[model samples]
Target: MEKIKTLNFAGYFRNFAPILLLFFITSTGFAFQDDRDFNEYSGEILNNKNGKAISSAYLSLNNSNISTVSNTDGEFSLKVPKDLMDATVTVSVLGFQSKTLPLDFFKVEGTEVRLIENVEELSEVTLYKATNARLLVQDMLAKKDENYLSDESIMTSFYRETIKKGWTNVSLSEAVVKIAKSPYNSSKKDLVSLYKARKSTDYDKLDTIALKLKGGPFNTLFLDMMKYTEYVLRDEMLDSYNFSFDQPTKINDRYMYVVDFKEIDESDPWYYGKLFIDAETSTLVKADYSLNVDDKKKAEMMFVKKKPSGSKVYPTELNYQVDYAQNGDKWHYAYGRAQMEYVVNWKKKIFNSKYKIDSEMVVTNWEKYAGDNWRSENTLIRPNIVMVDDVSGFNDADFWGSSNIIEPEKSIQNAIDKIKRKLD
Candidate 1:
């Protein structure tokens, strides 16, 4: 028999391994796990004072590499091994006190834990009279090496892309990926590989004329303005944007300077957004921006990869957000999200189709050492694959084995369950 070649969701290509489908079920503030292994626990993180949901809190077992983060609804699931049953798990967030609990604290249906807020006195504001906005941006760029990661590292990340037609979600694609993060001073691009991936089965509902997203992870990484300075913030481009100082905010107990940037020249397509700089360190900690798609024809050229001939498409919105978190003395890329909406007009223009596309990535775990460079053939890149059209079905409940991933929303879980019943 001729040999068959197949690649598993874990990024390994082996001969004769069973080809199985991976599916993620997201529901309303609920996490589902296999009862066969009761070690896997589910719970919610909340505020101790007001009992509000504490989104984006980090949780992990002490002395162990296994971990996961709470979703926007303050829910998470962590699988504990028999040996680690006695270990305490810690929950922490940027502006909250850390809370620890025993593994036995969680029940099958799940339990809730609250963390106290960490309030501190604000630092005295120092008004500088130098170049102002220009000088602040310059310092942010100059201190890249001193503030960001100095060495290459391996990061395990969760990636998700959703396509919506009007208000109904037609397609959802998600993956657990391993990324090779290059050093701040290096010119090499960050590398990503699929560790585990799955696609929603309701993809058939999508418009027959496909709405595709290109360069998955690569597209988001490029939005790291600090790393790709020339793309948006070159010295020459500085003149095109009107920069002003905004209110100072707090992040991780440290004060941050908010810089507002808007394109003064509307003659050309430009970007407008806010940059949050660490007040003491002058590092670009977070950026929330969007491309101005004023020129309909020009914006169409930026997003339309391939479409049916008679279909006329107009770009409506293009937005991007990237955030970094401090780890010890250095800060690393923590999470990134991009959202865009476009309207497609048919030949007559009377009937039009509107599409919303979104992508989110979160770095769950990282190590300073990856040993060796990832093989060229194993890299995930553009033009070769489109993540949404590639994945299908579910084979097991343990979709992500030992790796950390963002918990799915409750709506997604309920959708998965309903779909599974129909398929069966």
Candidate 2:
């Protein structure tokens, strides 16, 4: 009897300890499970009138932190707490009236939000040239940030133009470049000759020239000149010109402020034109200006340079135009056009190079890769072509240089490396 009683006491104690531990763990797990359960929904926006997909529309929850934009295909997915079953959702787009609906409007699984068209109020404001337009332009230019001058600055862009004369076309291109600090102290190389039919092919003669440009005088001089020109334009043209503001206009559902500028001094190299800026982002949307090329001295010097037999001089009465579109939270160039007419004098022969060059560049695609703020890997889709016509000259050979003279691979690689340094 005594042995039996003692065995029962130990057995009961051991059984109770395990049971208590198990209960504690089960309770803790249940608590965590409750916190982890969240409800999510996928949805789309549609034009109520047409029943078509609506893209770039903003969607947000009334009480929660969830918010997102519709994709190009007009589709979206969002997650929220299950307890938000009674919350409200709001959707909005520019030029369209906003809509708000209770969560109960859609079944918990997926929802379709309908947006109605909104009538915008029109303003009637007459725009005339302001007396202080020149002064206003100067002030704006002076206030331009110094970051614009840096090679690594995000605002840098590539520009190429094809001048079409009477019948033949040629390429005369320049890029808004930024100069980066380099490891090697090399000189600048000569222009690598490229083939007309296969522009990607580089000429061999430019090999020594390209290598010598590692830290060369030509590159240094070129960069210095570009920076100086930009600085001068911003300080003298933008800061000194007067402007007249016009009524706001709508572009891609964004409000924009339009301003016209005129030069204070006709002799100034400043362009006279109109500028459009996004009211919300304060970013430039468009700029259309006419430049004066009346400086006989500058024009003569530029014309005297023997532009390869086929190449023509830069245009006079140049019209510079730029258009922009939004990319995520940033603004980027959508399209650009530069038209000018120049007189080329080669071998004492007066050749009227009346040229119109246009370039249509678009961001066909983009992707994010690994890197830091100092550097990044980006691929660009550029569809570019150059058309040049010799309005005055009849010789087609004058425009055709020896093809395959420069190594295309080396020239392109060098150009890319130079761009990377500036970006850094």
Task: Give the top-scoring candidate (TM-score).
Answer: 1
List lDDT for all candidates, in order. 0.67, 0.39
Model 1 per-residue lDDT tens digits across residues 27-90: 2121223444436677789899998888767676776545667777898877666666789987
Q: Model 2 off-target regions past 4 Å?
A: 1-160, 170-197, 200-237, 302-314, 345-353, 372-424
Residue 243, model 1: Cα distance from true site in angstroms: 1.6
What does candidate 2's lDDT look like per residue over 111-184, in tens digits?
78888775454243233223353443443333333212112212222223333344333332232211121111
Query: TM-score per candidate, in order?
Result: 0.78, 0.40
Give per-model CA RMSD.
8.7, 27.2
Worst lDDT 10-window in candidate 2: 5-14
Report lDDT (Cα) of residue 327, candidate 2.
42
